[model samples]
Target: MTKFKKRPSKLKKFLGLLGPGLVTGASDDDPSGIATYSQAGAQFGLATLWLALLTFPLMAAIQGMCARIGLVTSQGLTVTLKNHYSKPLLYIMLLFSFPAITLNIGADIQGMGAVAHMIIPAIPVSVFCVAFTAILMFIIIKYPYQKIAKILKWLCLSLLLYMIVPFMIKQDWVLVVKNTFIPTIHFNKEFFSIVVAILGTTISPYLFFWQATMEVENMAQSKRKIIVNKRVLGDMRTDVNTGMVLSNLVMFFIILTTGSVLYNSGIRQIDTVDQAAKALEPLTGKLTYLIFAIGVLGTGLLAIPVLAGSQSYMLAETFGWEAGLDKKFPQAKAFYISIIISLLVGLSLDFLGISPIKALLFTAITYGLTAPILIAIILHIGNNKEIMGENTNSKFSNVLGFITLFIMTVAAVALIYFLFK
Candidate 1:
């Protein structure tokens, strides 16, 4: 008789549960996101910390819907949209998302190159930009999906530096707790813009595409047929929840650290990730600054692929060309070329001499406007019985998804109104 197999350790099991959700969540805090959060903290202090708490549940639900759509339909969101929605509508989405993602990629690459220059002043920012562009394009084209995903999961550990930063500085735990749980709103244009930027950076449209496509990628990687199983759905929920919580937790602490340190010190503007890191040196010393810089680099490496991959996935799906990171270069020529073109275009943006902070701010605003449209479309697909079949969103998911859509729409309108006012 065969002996009973020993059970896997709890930690190992939990680690196994993480995948698309974890990567998606971590990628949400890319360089652009860091800059936006830093701007929020430097300008409004802890007054905006409450948005972090508010967004976690909403982010989880929206991403969960995306993951379910992919898992159930066994197709990327774009493919599903192509099959079920009007061509004009699909093209409309592509028009909005493509440029926004490209701009984000450019801003993210710029941020990474800026931080690299700060670490090694001898190298020019253009060099770092070109190097990063080449490296990421190579990784996407050459690496297997599983290998790239594992590397991204490990890179997420770098974000822990933000959490540790607040402990190194003097923090008002009393006020931090109060502001985190209590909602605060400022009606001015700057505050409104920052709020929109924060929301945009947090619940981004690219993550929606990435989440759904990666879930499809996972299915294909597992060699599983397109079938819905209860165990798979449960695992997806756990992964999405854990990932969103981690993303928002980092956002909260980053805001807290900057608010306690830079805002308190009367440093009210962060024009770049380098400036933000440098501003923290006097309060938390060089070590913290170094870690912050490294975090920017690591997250950028993790995020640029997702941004480029999302665009490629949409284009390939729409045009009926083969697409998947797991495929060989020759097997998915159009897909790989799209990724290469996006990276190169973004690299060109770096040489244009746009200020990193200004570029990032503009990227955030673009995401803010585009995200709601995508969210509304996602909600429609998730609720469509033909597309999602029995895997359609439950009441809980629908409520949170609609709430997120509503909030984002209002924020978008508010941003424009305040700008004109």
Candidate 2:
């Protein structure tokens, strides 16, 4: 008998819908972001929960535009900029992006190492840091795009562990609900700095590059002639929005966890993910701490590849070198070499005596300063009829993108002002 193809189950369809956006979104809540959110909650209690509501739409809009840019252009953001924009702008992005992404990788590696040390006092943090660097390097070189993408998708589940932590302890549901809906503002340098950190960390520049490049890579690997059409864009939008929502939900639960467990007990000032995990052990016991620590490590594995890969992709595109996760090391030697160098440099930060907390804060500031400019460029690229053709930014997207630009501009200024003030 002639057989009909078995239809994919809804679960499989949903999973299929998830790709670059989901991984990018989940990676956004990397170890450094965890530190930022944990600090906000520990220091200010539930005051910042409402910010999650505000950022979700903004992040989705920007990431969606980026994915669209990649889809319509069939090229990474860097290539588009290189072809259309000025060389000065492209080089400047590279300069800031390299350090910003490298520092981010360093901080994540350190955070994961410290958390591992906490779990096993016998292992030295430096050793763990080096070991992680080696393992990550091997995986990037060993795996092609599909394998790496699959691994990243699976690692996204580690974020759910944070969701579990809040339920493990008794929480004031009413207080959490009140804080979720109510916006709280404290007018001070410290408060505004944390606000900027959250903004900068969530609406990051590297993820924009990574998202677009990933879409291009995804398309390149497919055997089918991927056309950029309404249905395709719709799927892309679904993926990006789903990722943004997942990322912010993890942020919400993390804030809730630290706000309830640490803030209520009179502890505050969580500067690092390891510190946040350590702080939880005494109060919420070892299990919650273990979950949080493991999540940190998982986020590092998910995020570092993104951090390093985006940096390398930026360089690859800028220099016209071969690139893509799909290319084997021999096929993309420079690409893999850059990844190795980034990981090594990041690992060296710990051994070089640079503090991870400072690295993370600097990384945030770097991103804060650079993000607004990149957003403006993305807006222009998205709207340029020659570049995007029929896939230009919609009115709603333009509105959200402009709002994000305005907010990020104000936040960037505030972050700098606070630094000098």
**For candidate 1, lDDT tens digit of each residue in 15-105?**
8999999999999999989988998999988999999999999999999999999898888998888988899988988988887788889
Task: Show how many residue pairs clash in every candidate, following the order shown.
Answer: 0, 0
Candidate 2, residue 325: lDDT: 83
What does candidate 2's lDDT look like per residue over 212-235, in tens digits?
999999999899999889999999
Where does candidate 2 stray beyond 4 Å? none
lDDT winner: 2
* lDDT (0 to 1) per candidate: 0.90, 0.93
Give TM-scores for every candidate, taking all chains together and pairing residue i with residue i: 0.98, 0.98
